[model samples]
Target: MVLRFLFLFLVLLYSAKVNSQLLTDELARLNNLGAVFDDLNNDLKQAKKTKSISQTTMAHYNLAIFCSNHRVYTEALHQYNNTINLLEEKKNDTLYAKVLNQVGSIHLELRNYNYAKDYFIRSEKAAELIRDSVLLALATSNLGSCFEKQKKYKEALEYQNKSLQIFYKLNNDSGLAIVNESIGSIYEDLENYKLAELYFKKALKYNKNEKNSRLASIYNNLGDTYRKTNRLNIGLDYTNKALSTAVEIKNTLEVASAYKDISKSYNLIGDYKNAYTFLQSFLKVDTENKRLQSANQSNALQHIYNSKEKESQIQYLLQLNKANKSQKLVLVVLVFMVVVFGVVWYLYTLKKRRHISKELDFKQRILKIELDKKQAEEKNLQKQLHIKTASLSRYSLHLSQKNKMLSNLSLTLKNSLQRNNVDLKRKLTELIKEIDFNLAQEKEWDEFMAFFKEIHPNFINKISNAVTSKLSPAELRLCILLKLNLSSKEIASILRLTPDSVRVARYRLRKKLPIDSKEELSLYLMSF
Candidate 1:
């Protein structure tokens, strides 16, 4: 009986180990797949050469993401449509549903609010069908954002709350961080800067020491909050950080927004030069966006107006025709009294009404012609917006790729340790610890650069020399790592250094830079 019990325990242990190994392997593959997706154009080329359906689907999805990033809505839409077709054949409903959400997101980014809402609703349905809480939460969160953009404050808050509840239940830290940020944005829009700041700070705490593009947005909101509270200096400081982060992430739109916020702060303080500088930046971003969408919306509006105007004219003309028919009948009835002066007056009035009707008909034709012109313009604008949205989506993907390297390292380390491979375990543990440490604080940027320089000496020198900022190789490495939001431990592992050594390097990097002691070194590096 004792032998039987021991055998059962061993079997269970082995089963558990196998399961863990499988999960880790799957995760690693997924991570690498995601990294490959970052360079979709190249991947597609390779996939075409291999004729792999999975690769094809992946390529299509990657292309869709790229299109979405660049604001190429139609192209993105096409890619997604093709991907769905491929996914359908493979019977991968889970991924299909996720793609639906992506489509919804693209629509939302394009400002097609109703279309966006429809897509999100469909995505939520798909998630429900698949019983995927993560997908459900993501769909709900997207709906909340859509409502927020539409200025449906109460509805937006409710959606956000729903998403937050799901994220909490799922114990998804990243989702929770996003929810916190969304909540903060709603408060900011409602003019409750205090509450907004509270939420922003919560999100910041959650996302600390990471290269999260969302953090830049939160920073921008925090700056706005500070400005609203009449803390101009604080506002400027935060805005600068936000701007720096946006630049690091290559998020032109957010960078433009940050500049506008800074300009507003400067304007409030009567610093015209700074304000003007920011305004120019704002204008550049705004003009480009407006050039893409304004004409389309205007043309659409004009077409609708003109169509209505023509319809109204037609109704009036019909009424005039009816009146003329009645007049003709009266004239015929009065034919016997043609010699009477009153009959002459009646005929003259009928002729005058006919002339007026002819002029009105002419105007209606002109209006219809104008409407056609407006419709054409609207199409052009839509095309431009599609292009821009697609462009932006690519940048977002790039950000994701850069951050995934650290995650991969962590996963690899964890796997090696479990395998009981002593050398591999030690190496992975060291790496995991290093990443964790870099992420432990907000000022590990300098340390990250030093590590980066050690890995890519040539690239660091090139980038450094190209820029006016004389950041040392170490500082530059730190800057790139900071952009990725690596934990100190992760940085150390990548650089093959002790945790203490990593800390000392970070200290030296900070001391070498010209920044306030309290300011985050990553934020400082981004400013350049």
Candidate 2:
């Protein structure tokens, strides 16, 4: 009877421990949700004030997510690093895994595929150690996504299958649905439209609540698969479903993405009017999202607050100084009257007034100098910012152009692969090589000449036509390299030519351009 009572007591204790763990889990979820909402509201100040390490870690993680969604990658990376450090310090293995997953996602968005893969692998390792089925599933799915992006369909399928198995064992319906959709996406990529559609439909059947964004994504995927199979009406139907679901959920970002998909579908079907309509909607939504994000940053409000606070402090100091000076003047006048009577006091007062005047003049001069120095510093900072902004903008624009060109080149390369046409493959390779060359020398003499023409529009056509005849593209490239003070070997390496060829090109350029026999090309090029 006593043994039976002890068994009952042990059972009760075990039950209580389970209940406590459950409470802790619920609290953690609540904290994470609160942090996410705070980040969404741009309440960073309040988030930092929470004092809980978990809360701060979650807040930083959420802010990273927010920044990444808005394409502010540097800021996202900053927040992600902070979150990682905090989570690591706490030794919160589960949260650490989750944060690593988020970091991987950001790196994926940044196109740092290798780094993304590394982070995902680390996340999977943590999840495996913890035996956290949900996180393990998440890590597997994310790793699958990275492989899919790299076009490793077989590997992607393996990872996705593994994730699906885990999700099924855990009865994680949402995860199962997502893995199915991902599998379908890979099938579509492999050009197995029927198989893709089958998987997508399978996922849809389990998507009862329509609460998951994966549902909308799968609908869009099905639409794309149908479009590929030349089923325009079916594609339109699925795209419309996606649009409806996205809108119903008030997922503005997803809504914009849906509109973009719809536009592409219509474009594929040659329905220009419908395509244009959706395109306009997509643009409008995107612009509104950007504007909303900028507004949330509150840069202007913070600047104004900082300025007002500084001005108030300066005013308070000025008032204090004036009071101190007045008291000193009164004390001095009293002392002078006691020591030497009214005449001496009057003389001392005159002398003191003159000394004060001189001191005031000196202070004014010093203020002027300080003001001038501050103005100069402000101008320098503005100049530096302008240069940095311009450089960043140029880099961004260049990368965009390169991406477009690379996409075209990839399509061309794929076509060559399909046809098994050696000549076509060689030509495509040459084209790709030319693009790489152009990218490498994008800011060469040709670009400078173009820029020069922009500054001097009247002579543009004449100068351009003249320059074209005198300088072949290779010669122009060599000239630019030379102007940059690069050696012949460096120029050759850049242009994939021999040093002897570069020298020949330089000789030709000197003959073509207005350089004298004794003139240094580098000096002349930099003169402008």
Each prediction's number of clashing residue pairs: 44, 0
Error of 1 at 520 (Å): 99
Query: In lDDT terms, which candidate is top?
Result: 1
> 288-335, model 2: which lDDT tens digit per residue?
656555654443234334544765898899999998998999899889
lDDT of residue 42 for candidate 1: 60
State the lDDT at 158 in candidate 1.
97
Q: Which segments of candidate 2 are over 4 A away from where they belong?
A: 1-71, 89-92, 264-272, 286-528
Per-model TM-score, in order, reads 0.44, 0.46
- The Cα error of candidate 2 at residue 521, in Å, is 78
Instruction: Report lDDT per candidate.
Output: 0.73, 0.71
Q: Write the per-residue lDDT of candidate 1 for residues 189-299, one digit (tens) a residue.
A: 998988899989888877777766887888888898999999988988788788777666655567668878988998998878768866876776566445434543343
Worst 10 residues of 1 by lDDT: 391-400
